[model samples]
Target: METYDKIGINYNKTRKVDQRIASIIEENLQPKGINLKLLDVGAGTGNYSNFFSSKGYNVTALEPSEIMLAQASHNNNIKWIKGSAEDIDIQDNFFDGVFSVLASHHFNNLQLAISEINRTLKSKHFAVIFNADPSLVSKKSWLFDYFEIVFEKAISKYINIESFKSLIQSTANTHVKIIDYPLPDNLTDNFFASGWKKPSLYLDQTFISGISPLASLETNTLNLIQERLENDLKNGTWNNKYGQILEENHFDDGYRFLIWQKP
Candidate 1:
């Protein structure tokens, strides 16, 4: 069974597409035009795939998890395929553009996946939106203070931005551009760090369950973290330390858009 298959039951309830991020993706691929033949590698639940399809792009939504794919909204413009990133079952130079959002960390082999993306992209343009190395972003995160172990583990899982840029450039001979994406206060998507400003949302079991790192924690660990967080919020301890962040409208928590294009 795929990893998301086990944890994706309530995914759609919280992982809706934030149009602000969607528009950025659209703008990145818009140069290719609406007739672009696009592939969404790791199209978990097809939120972005459906978004692009609705805008008139012919999108192939490839995902390894049946549970995630099953939850995708039915759309005539999207051709859904059950597949993995490292071994895409598509013809060579087939797609005009390819994109993946918040899904690369779960890949079994990052190098092979990049090779496959290069192999199948006719335009040799690949755009991926993912978290940078957690070490760079977690220093200011409340998660680092509360869920120390889980946050540390996540730091090891995420790729360093510089290393990832070098990898993409070396592997595919593509020019890579990094775009910083700050988490908006009103972000609709409830990913791991989306609740940066609204810390209380982390106390919700359903919300945390939708995040892989937090969801994977043992019951006791989660209970302890929740208890500590609740105490901090009630006593104004959390606000004393991190309350200044609440005044900001958005935060740059190492979320970035990496666009790779072959010259």
Candidate 2:
């Protein structure tokens, strides 16, 4: 809880579920024509859990941080549980499906976590939504130039795409499919990458801190980067250089949808 508690306060206040992202997640869940019991690994505040529940699937939203889990909405269809990805407390082979979105990086032990995900899932149908490979971060990110240190440190924590595939494959004998997910024009999640099109959102102190990587930066460094970004936006330097990002509806910022199933 040390890791998540540091940044879980007021999480739901800034992080709202984006329908566009939700639609993609729903698609990846691959409903099997009936009510399914799904487990949301590292579920922050039951956003996705509630989404699945609304669609008639029984959802269990697991989060280790009490502060974050407390923010979740109370729904009869969705059960909120206190747990961690590395060691899930649920019974073995219980869930019809398991899904983890933007939460893998938080796992203390990646292999153990995947093993638990595999153990809990009743079958091979599972999805893990991970942020894009570190190498692809700079390709379309505006923060790379302004907050290199923050982004670099953040990238170090992410499990490489290939490495993730190997881990999942070893844990479960299933065919893994990786798909790129681009930032939508009106992305509502407010994560670090969600602000690519709306640069000003990055300058907001509260908004930036809500993102783990950016929040991990020293206060002095964070302030300096914010100042620089603010000045650039006001002086038109941001638009003059990265103006093209505004023209595009979506940018590929290293988000990938990993779906696995038995062949």
Candidate 3:
């Protein structure tokens, strides 16, 4: 959880919401001056929460990281609380809308989190975005090959998309429908694409350090990824093999977004 706080500080340095994805989410939002109340669970450093709040929505950010929560409180003009996906204590049927990002993979009890989300949002017209994806080990790439060799660990938190979907369905009442939303257009400009395009030499060392591996895994595993990245860049090995990543328009990773709506 504390790793998120480090992420919060480093977040804006590298993380900005993509405009195209924002457009999709924004379309489903309550129009301006409508005074919609919302919650951003696991809203570390108020990434998307900051954007929603800035748009005049009454957004409350709930996060468990004390350092991240503190920074979120200080940096944003929104309500900040200390909490996790499980055991969220807000009143039932309170928020008009709710959202979370990237944090679902960390949820140890997915059903409880889903139940809490369903319990807290208004009975009808509530919408959410989630994902069902597998825990992946990169075997095809030269970079990840080095990673697997050095770091004897895995990154996926038992990635099981079907199981994740079932957990949400079991907890949610009949009113909720889980639908797959198209990948947001700006995800690339915001995260992977922008970096993959820049020469590895141009990337910041600190930004690289902020990326987290699965908590259940070993830290030594990262050494493989790190060592390989360092070695390949120096030896011109990576550039020769995967230089196209910089020019690539889009790529897919394991994670995908699922939208839950109350109808």
Evaluated with TM-score, which candidate comes out highest?
1
Each candidate structure's TM-score, on Cα atoms with residue i matched to residue i, is 0.95, 0.93, 0.78
User: What TM-score does candidate 3 get on C-alpha atoms?
Assistant: 0.78
Q: Return the clash pairs for model 3, or none.
A: 130-258, 135-159, 151-221
Best candidate per lDDT, number? 1
Instruction: Tell me the spans in candidate 3 whose CA falls farther than 4 Å from its real position.
Output: 5-12, 28-33, 73-77, 130-138, 141-143, 146-158, 174-203, 214-224
What tens digits encode model 3's per-residue C-alpha lDDT throughout 1-263?
A: 75565555555555555655555555554333477888888776677787787787888888898767665634444788788889787998888888876677666687788888888888665556544342432456433444343223334444466666666666674433344433332353233223434435223554553344422224565454566677778898878887766565654434455556544
Give the alpha carbon lDDT tens digit for every residue of 1-263 in model 1. Answer: 34588668988988888888888876775445457788898888999898888888899999998889778887788999998999999998888788888888888898899889889987645555454557667565675787778768877887888888888888888788888887889888898888988889989978886788888888898898899999999999999998898898988777888887744
Clashing pairs in 1: none
In candidate 2, stretches whose alpha carbon ends up further than 4 angstroms from where it belongs are 139-141
Candidate 1 is scored at a TM of 0.95
